[model samples]
Target: MTESDGDQPTRQRWILIRRSISGPDEITYYLACAPLDATVTDMVHIAGSRWKIEECFQSAKNECGLDQYEVRRYVGCYRHIILLFMLVQAFLAVMAV
Candidate 1:
């Protein structure tokens, strides 16, 4: 970071990958960030698996109301999470029969 960089806000560096071989008209780009010491292969793996992680989180939230919490206390929050997980499991079990 430079002197004028305002406190080095980044802990990782971002890189962009453009599919140049696909030609400009058919081009696609993927942007991702990784630690400064991370290898290209490690970054590639992280970028590749990112979609699957996101998909699982989205499915959990939508089907299980995982993001519907409104509790403030720590214990309340834990209880909500535990019950919600159990409810989701029960739903999956019922559907399997």
Candidate 2:
């Protein structure tokens, strides 16, 4: 598929739909590539795998001070994230001991 960008037709992303077995709601997804071996179920499964990582991020923000920043500068934000992640790692290490 192509998208009109000025005078050229650029590559356009296409979406796939997956419906729940028990609910009327559906999930729409897009892939960077269409692998020959992957089916719709595989695509959905792959997409759903990110939820675990997302939940982990949420847990860090909620419990480990991952997002507890009040800085406005870009460098300050970066520093906050780096420092907070290090602090979280230390906390986890102490917990494991």
Candidate 3:
């Protein structure tokens, strides 16, 4: 992929993985940036983990009000996110009992 940063164009190598067992419509395409020697297994693993990561963020947003904040500063936003994660961790710990 080529992206322009100001005036210079930077090129990045992206790998496309087509995962499907049935038809063309059922195919899942994954575009990822990885090493030239990276295998299909590595790309698949990375793609699979994306769902879990998104789920965790969604859970945080839903249960902890993680997305409800309106902070103007970077440090404030960072602290708010950290606090939300701490709250989530505590909630999980209590539920595990």
Candidate 4:
């Protein structure tokens, strides 16, 4: 679709729906922006990965206190995340032994 200025075309958006097999009334919807040639499977894969990423973040928050602090600067935030992940990695490595 054209922008309000009518000078450029806007990127296309697609909405995908997932329904639970056991509960037909339960539904999940995802809004996505992808290339014109992207397939349904591609979109599904990309959307499915979001859950894993979210789970990782939640795990970090719960297990490593990832969200326990606040930083006002980019460098501070970066350092915090690096340290947090290092702690997580060390913990995982010890658990693997």
lDDT of each: 0.65, 0.66, 0.70, 0.75
Prediction 3 global C-alpha lDDT: 0.70
lDDT of 1 by residue, 56-83 (tens): 6576677777678666788986767756
Q: How far out, in Å, is residue 63 in model 3?
A: 0.5
The Cα RMSD of model 1 versus the native structure comes to 6.8
- The 10-residue segment of model 3 with minimum total lDDT is 10-19
lDDT for each residue of candidate 4 in 1-97, tens digit (9 for 90 to 100):
1223275544456798988799999999998876656778999999889888788767777667778867689897787775767578568758979
* Candidate 3 structure quality by residue, lDDT tens digits, 1-97: 5555687655445666565657756666666666546666777778888878788777777767778867789897787766767578569758979
lDDT of the structure predicted as candidate 2:
0.66
Q: Return the lDDT, model 3, position 91.
A: 90
Write the residue-wise lDDT of candidate 2 on 1-97 in tens digits.
4456698655454465656678858655555444444566766777778777677677677777777756678898676775677678668858979
Ranking of models by TM-score: 4, 3, 2, 1
Q: Per-prediction RMSD in angstroms? A: 6.8, 5.4, 5.2, 4.0
Model 3 CA deviation exceeding 4 Å by range: 1-12, 15-29, 74-83, 86-90, 93-97
Residue 7, candidate 3: Cα error in Å is: 22
Where does candidate 4 stray beyond 4 Å? 1-11, 21-26, 73-83, 86-97
Residue 36 lDDT in candidate 1: 56
Question: How well does each candidate superpose onto the true structure, as a TM-score?
Answer: 0.44, 0.48, 0.58, 0.64
